[model samples]
Target: MSDVETPETAEKEELLTEAEKKALIALRRDEAAALRRWWQRLTLTPHELEKLTKQRSLPRGVRAVLRRCDSAEAAMLTQGFRELWAMLPESTKQTDYRDEQLQVWSCIALVAAELRKEESGVSLAKRLGQQKEQTGKPLMSELRFQQLLSCRTPEEFIQRLRRALALADKKGVSVVLLASVIALWWREHRGRLSAKPTQRLGFVLANDYFAATSGYSHRKD
Candidate 1:
């Protein structure tokens, strides 16, 4: 083997890196599409929706254990969650990101189960910003929205997210978008070190929230 690197070898290595990047992007797109499809199915099937919603009312202790992802208790307590997990892309079920996927999936199922409508197209943060209280303020206060983003655990996130989802349901926000954003948020949270500066999930959501709120406030004014 030669000690010195040749230009040809360096070019080959660069091309290989680019190929890997493209492959990763494609894989993520496929996974996201699969997740959206699963959420759409849940919305269309009333019986399945009913069963999943029941998981929300399970004892707090059981719900806490459900956050463990690998627990047999979670598997036994919610067949719906298991089915949802099974429907996810095989890459998501792999050991590498399995626990994070489950944590995100559980929260999505719980928050989405609270939705009264299954509409699509709008982002969750914008929908929340657009919704108004009877007193003519944004339904989700800035303080509350900040708190939601600041949650330190899955349990806290789910609890606040369910309340937010309920308000979103009143406005008929998109269930698919809602679930997908939460999934994206979880991925960003877990991989913050590797995430691009332009792609910060919190910044994206804050933009959506504040932009909508600004427009809404102006209209109200």
Candidate 2:
């Protein structure tokens, strides 16, 4: 009788083990088709969501740099690159590889290809950096560019890129919001000067706001 299993004990034994349950959870996460929880966890408040969603609010360059792609996967990867772009230590608006714009692009292109276990990090970095000029402005569809970064083996690179992009996008949004606040302050205070009515952003302070938001220096010096 001690060795014989009863109905309750049998039912308990049928339940999934911890490892099996974890595997099932992982499988579901991968099968979701949209990598929602992974990316969407970066939340925003209702007010911020309202602001960021407005079509006219985001600057043209910022919009282009952070625009969502049609393919869910491609959108994630391209955004990964853009975010990575802002974090790299760079001299603002410089025209050389030392600026890191092209270098990160080159890295994106190389890691998108086969992992080639034969490759070493040093060799890979050289190849990636050397051919960045070719990676600039790919004429292919956005999905193709995402496909380039979807290297299956040794997945650490894209993980890092995705993190960098998140940082960049956050900073980009902060800049836009801060500029808008400054613009609002100027619009209210300019009233004391008895200035004539004009375009919303044509005043000197407005121009400075634009320049600051662009991450560009408007000064002649």
Candidate 3:
């Protein structure tokens, strides 16, 4: 009878352990679902969501660099790189050969990509600087002259270029344009702008708004 009682108690303990494990798994799933919903609320597109949702936590130094991103767009790019790198297997990451050093290289690549896409050559050159690193070489010719020439209007192109420059972590010729935009917004929309960094981003959005408005104009005046 004593032996039977001991076996029965052991089986009951195992059942409780299994029940606890199920509860913990349910809790983790619930937490993950809540995180996904919150991320969706941040206005990430499907592509961006896929990139960000799969990342492991960044190392402290890398996370600090990402947090220091000057623009929301740059921050998005940083997040993209982090998630992309994290998705790579440990062996793949080791083969790529830079572990933590990859963050700085990735920063340069991201800034270069943005500049090339936005046709901000003058700013790109300044950001690339006097001492050229191997990472900077990959971007030198990716930014083409023809892309800048395709602009419909000089002002439109300049504004887009300025926005890209403003996002760069380094000093560049277009820093003046960035400062001017900030000052203009501060003067014109004092009440709305305030101390909020995001409010100052109206300059970038204003370009799109103006372009849309321009498209609707008829020359009948």
| The candidate that achieves the highest TM-score relative to the unseen native structure | 1
Query: Per-residue lDDT of 1-221 in model 3, one digit per residue for the tens?
Result: 01111113333233223322332211222222222222222233456545534423333343444435654346445653454334323443464435432433233223322321221112233332222243323121224322432334323444444444543433332222222333233233324443644333343334322333343233334
For residues 1-221, could you state the per-residue lDDT of candidate 1 as single tens digits?
A: 11111123333233223322332321254444444444444444545534432221222333233344343234334644654566555667787766666677766665655565654455677777874855556778889999887876665766777778766654466555666567666766675533564455577568778878887577645
Candidates in order have lDDT scores of 0.56, 0.28, 0.33
**Which pairs in model 2 have colliding backbones?**
83-165, 112-148
The order of the candidates by TM-score, greatest first, is 1, 3, 2
RMSD of 1: 12.9
| Candidate 2 lDDT score at position 134 | 39
What lDDT does candidate 1 reach at residue 147? 89
Better of 1 and 2 by TM-score: 1
Better of 1 and 2 by lDDT: 1
Q: How accurate is candidate 1 locally (lDDT)?
A: 0.56
Q: Is candidate 1 or candidate 3 better by TM-score?
A: 1
Residue pairs in collision within model 3: none
Model 3 segments more than 4 A misplaced: 1-44, 47-67, 70-81, 89-91, 99-101, 108-221
Please provide the root mean square deviation of candidate 3 (C-alpha atoms, Å). 22.6
TM-score of model 1 vs. true structure: 0.65
